[model samples]
Target: MMKEEVLSVLVSNHFGVLTRVTNLFGRRGFNIKALSVGETENPAFSRITIITEGDEQTLNQIQKQLSKLEDVKKAVIIPDDLLISRELLLIKVSADAENRPQLDALISEYSAKIASQQSDCLTLELTAAPEVLNLFIEKMRSYGIMEMCRTGSAALALGTQTVYHDAK
Candidate 1:
């Protein structure tokens, strides 16, 4: 069975690092489902969160390959139980006087923020788990979606567990 895995990588914050990492995945024929990268607490390093689907052996190989990269300091698969993740979504939906009330109620139910509104459309912002965002997207479809953008998932390990470089 295919399993979704999240790999957190700690790497030097330098130019071309992201390209090299992504290229590695492409060369191995692995499809990245989602990817998010940002500077870590220490400015010299960055954290990369990658979501992919594959069998156990494939996941292990991907982790090993990521660790072999020059800029990568640490790479580890964060177990789902120990992972805390969220994604940001911005959706624009058609809205007029007739359906505005119902749309407002739906937005309130999802805790989505009103980013903007116009006579013809309303833009809403939501930050939540991937599954929640997916459901919200489906709900908006009925209201006639104009456009939407979703960011890749960003995650952290629960409690004290963390992926970090050990240069000692």
Candidate 2:
């Protein structure tokens, strides 16, 4: 059975580190559904959160491969129930006097912000769970989406868990 898994990877913050880390997944024939990477509190380290779908054994293999990389400090799977994840969605939807009021209702319903507005369209900014963002996109389709850009999932374990507990 295929299952979605989120992996938190701690690595050295330097050029080409992301490429090398992602290459491990490519070599194992695993597709990354979502990936977010950024420097950690410590400037020399980075945290990479990856979302992928695979059966148990394959996922385990990918984790092991990630740990073996020169730049990888640690790689661990984060359980869904214990994870807190969010993504940013920026969408430009068609709007005019006829539909502006309806679009305003949707924006209020979802707590989305009007990032910008033009005579013909409204650009909205929403940061929410991936599923919520997906639903919002579906809702906007009827209104006509001019363009959209969404970031990959950025996540961390809830409560006391820390991905970089031992980083120096």
Candidate 3:
């Protein structure tokens, strides 16, 4: 059975680390569904949230390989059994006076927030599971979608603990 995994990696904020990490996945032939990388609050570090789809054994191997990289401080595979995952999507829909109200109602049904509005378009921001976001995108197609952006899944382990592990 195909499964999806979210990996949160903490690495030194250095050039080429992203490429190296991505190359590792590429070498393994795992398709990355979504990837988000940003500097952490700490100036010296960055966090990478990667979503990939593969079988369980392949996912495990990818995690192990990522953890072994020199720049990688820690790599944790968020298990399906113990994490809450979500992605943020910004969708700009083409709208006109005639269909504006209808689009507004559809956005409300999805509980999307209006991030911006212009005479020709309305940008809606939604935070939900990937499936929900995909559903919204599909529905908006009929209304004419101008553009969209999605933040790859960011997940946290459920409970009071964090995923960081220090290596001496």
Candidate 4:
């Protein structure tokens, strides 16, 4: 059955590598829900975390195709049972004198921070699991969110496992 999957890919940290990976998804007709790429511990390589939807067969094909790419070293699904993941959000909400304290208290309750503040609005910065961020968004809707930016989820296998380790 087709279902959501998170993939961790290790690739050469060079120009065109990101393009190549994204193209693979487009070529295969798979929709990418979210993608994040950054340099790994070794500057020579990069780690990409991708959230997509596919079945077992499609996922297998993705793994094989990614491994065949010149710049891709490995691609493996990060099972929720063995994964640790988070996304970052920066949100600006309307906060006047009457509601400022309430917003501040709500932010503190969630361990979020006020990145900046103005007479009419307050910007909050938070890093947490996607679900937590969603709940925050839902609660803040009543306060009138002025703007928001989110960094798509990035994930890693829990414990000592490395992204580059060969999956068997």
Candidate 5:
């Protein structure tokens, strides 16, 4: 059965590294649902978070290919059973005097914070699992969403273990 996977890859922060990694996915015809890349706390490397959906064999192949890239220092596919994953979403919804109170109540019920407020719109920030975020988005659709942005899933393994290919 196909399942979603979140992978954390460490690579050299160099020109074309991002292109190379993305090209690998494109060449394999894998659909990337979301991707976030940023410099790590260490200056020498960068972290890339990729969310993709595929069966076990396809995911394994993608991991093997990613590991072969020269710029990649480590590529770890976080198994569903061992990972704690969450994403942050910022949503701007249309609101006026009529619906403001109802929207505020919905936001509170979802445990979302109002990041900004204007005369006609409200911006809410929510952090939760992807499924929860999707549900929240659906709920906001009735009120008319002006804009929305989501941070791709960021994940860490549970317990004391860390997935480091170099240490393996």
Candidate 6:
């Protein structure tokens, strides 16, 4: 059975590397649910956090293939329960003077903030674990979410272990 999986891949920050990795998944008919890539502490390398759903066998195959690639240093599944992860969401919701108080309450309850306000709508910015962010969006649905955008999760292993790469 396919289940949620998060892979932390350490790779050389070189051109066409991302395409190669994504092509591997495409060839196997796998869809990446979320992917976030950014520079690591060492500017020469980048960490790619990919979230997808696949069975153990498929995950193993992908990991093995990734490790064998030219610029890929290593690929390992970061256990969902054993990692620190965060996602960011920006949402613009319908609001007015009468609804401001209730919106304020939501902001307080979820530790979010009113990023901007317009004549009849307001925008909010929230960053948190997936579950908490989902809940906040659900609650805000009642007020009509006008626009929204979310970034793929950024995650790291829970302990001191870090994904290492060959930086030459």
| Candidates' RMSD to native | 1.3, 1.4, 1.7, 1.8, 1.6, 2.0
Residue pairs with clashing backbones, model 4: none
Candidate 4 yields a Cα-based lDDT of: 0.88
Best by TM-score: 1
- Residue lDDT tens for model 3, 1-168: 788788889888989999999999888787888998888877888889898888878888888898899999888887778878889999999889999888889889999999999999999999998889999999999999889999887777888666555631
Where does candidate 3 have its weakest 10-residue lDDT segment?
159-168
Model 2 per-residue lDDT tens digits across residues 42-160: 89899898999999998999888898888999888989889888999999999999999889999999999999999999999999999899999999999999999988888888998
lDDT of 5 by residue, 7-55 (tens): 8888898789999999999999986999988887778788888998899
Q: What order do candidates take by lDDT, descending?
A: 1, 2, 5, 4, 3, 6
TM-score of every candidate relative to the true structure: 0.96, 0.95, 0.90, 0.93, 0.92, 0.92
Candidate 5 global lDDT: 0.88
Candidate 2 vs candidate 4: the lDDT winner is 2
Give the 10-residue window scoring lowest on summed lDDT in candidate 2.
159-168
The deviation in Å at residue 150 for candidate 6 is 0.7
TM-score, prediction 1: 0.96
> Where does model 3 exceed 4 Å of error?
166-168
Q: Determine the backbone clash count of candidate 4.
A: 0
Displacement of residue 22 (Cα, Å) in model 1 is: 0.5
- Which regions in candidate 1 have their CA more than 4 angstroms from the true location? 165-168
Scored against the true structure, residue 36 in model 2 reaches a CA lDDT of 90
Candidate 2: where is the Cα deviation over 4 Å? 166-168
For model 6, residues 43-145, the per-residue Cα lDDT tens digits are 8788888988888888888888888888888888887678788988999999999988999999999999778989899999999987788899999999999
Q: What is the total number of backbone clashes in candidate 5? A: 0
Candidate 5 or 1, higher lDDT: 1
Q: Count the backbone clashes (under 3 Å) in each candidate.
A: 0, 0, 0, 0, 0, 0
